[model samples]
Target: MFPIRDHNPSGRVPYVTYTLLAVNIAVFLFYWFSLPSDFALAKFYYTWGVVPAWLMQGEGYSGLITHMFLHGGWMHLAGNMLFLWIFGDNLEDQMGHVGYLLFYLACGVLAALLQVAGDPSFDGPLIGASGAIAGVLGGYLVLFPRAKVDVLFIFVIFFRVFSISAWIVLGIWFAVQSFNGYAATDDGVAYLAHIGGFIAGAVLVLPVLMRRGGAGFWARNQGKPPHPAAEYPVTPSRIPRVPRR
Candidate 1:
């Protein structure tokens, strides 16, 4: 199951979020077309993507930032952008454009550092904006824990959409990442970076939360977005339901 959308909408357009999406897509297209072979693509990734060994060796310092824009495949780019699209605007709405952008970059860099620290010897390239997007999720959880997010759950032939609380969704996600990171699973995913980015995001947003009145913020908004929660018309699923034998 994955999130499809959220019931909370930002009060204003999130220009930074949109621009980040466009830039990531553009960068992916640029390398996808320019590179003719898998070898070349791998070489490009090594140069731009964060390699724990190189980074720990005090080299390729720029990869910490550049790596956030480099994605391994279309699905990687799509998944990260989708999360950003859903949760980023609200955080941007609270933090403002410049501040959100800085927060995103800082989270990405810190996440990379944690990943490097986790396995300083790993030589593979780590690429994607997931770490930064995870940061947005972290901030969203703190600011709007009760916001309703519509998640699409599919079990083989059966599929359904469920509107659940933000904390449950993000909380579960963080838990899974934490477990995987601690287990040191070889899934080629940077779970450590995700963990670090999430913590960094949550901590970074504390100032904003305090400005809004700390616990009073939660008391006032009741952990939901300040604006009226959006109501989506329930539409029947297109898939035909099969009768159980």
Candidate 2:
């Protein structure tokens, strides 16, 4: 299942979120088109992507920030951007543009640090905005746990859309990351970074949550979006429901 969108709407335009989306896409396109070969692309990634070994060696210091802007492939970019588009606006609205931007970068840097701590001897290039975007998801859960998100569920030929609470979605996501991190298989994914970013986001956003009234904030909104949620018309599926014989 993948989250296609959310019913929650931001109170104001999220300029920083949009800019981040544009910048990530732009950077991906620039290197994708400009780099003539796979080797050159790999070289570029090494220069910008976070390499735990290098970072631990006191090198590639810039990768902590730069790596968040890089993606390994089209799907990588699309998935991260989709999450950002869905959850980022609400955060940007709550934190304000400048605050949200700083939070995002801080989460990304912290995520990388956690990944480096996880495997300081590994030399592979860790590239993607997911570490940061995971933070957005983390913050969204704390701020709007009951907000409805429309997730598209696909199972072989069967397809359906389900509107579920944000906490369930983000909670499951964090659980999976935690499981994978502990599994410790060489799957080429930075599960530790995801965990770190998510924790960082939840902890960092606590101050804002407190300012709003801590648990009282949840009492006031009942964990739903602070504003009226956007309504989506339920579309009937083309597949006919068969009656049991």
lDDT of 2 by residue, 1-245 (tens): 98999997898999999999999999999999999999999999999999989988899999999999999889989999999999999899989899999999999999999999988999989989988998888899999999899999999999989999999999999999999999986778899999999999998899989998989988888897688889898789999999999
Tell me how candidate 1 scores on lDDT. Answer: 0.93
In the predicted model 2, the residue pairs found to clash are none
Off by more than 4 A, model 2: 235-245
TM-score of 1: 0.95
TM-score of each candidate? 0.95, 0.95
The Cα error of candidate 1 at residue 26, in Å, is 0.7
User: In candidate 1, what residue range of length 10 has the lowest lDDT sum?
Assistant: 225-234
- Give candidate 2's error at residue 94 in angstroms: 0.7
| Stretch of 10 with least lDDT, candidate 2 | 220-229
lDDT of 1 at 198: 98
For residues 1-245, what per-residue lDDT tens digits would candidate 1 score against the true structure?
Answer: 99999997899999999999999999999999999999999999999989999988898889999999999898998999999999999899999999999999999998988999989999999899988888889999999999899999999999999999999999999999999998989888999999999999999999999999999989998898887888899789899999999
Q: Backbone clash tally for model 2?
A: 0
Count of residue pairs whose backbone atoms collide, per candidate: 0, 0
- Report lDDT per candidate: 0.93, 0.92
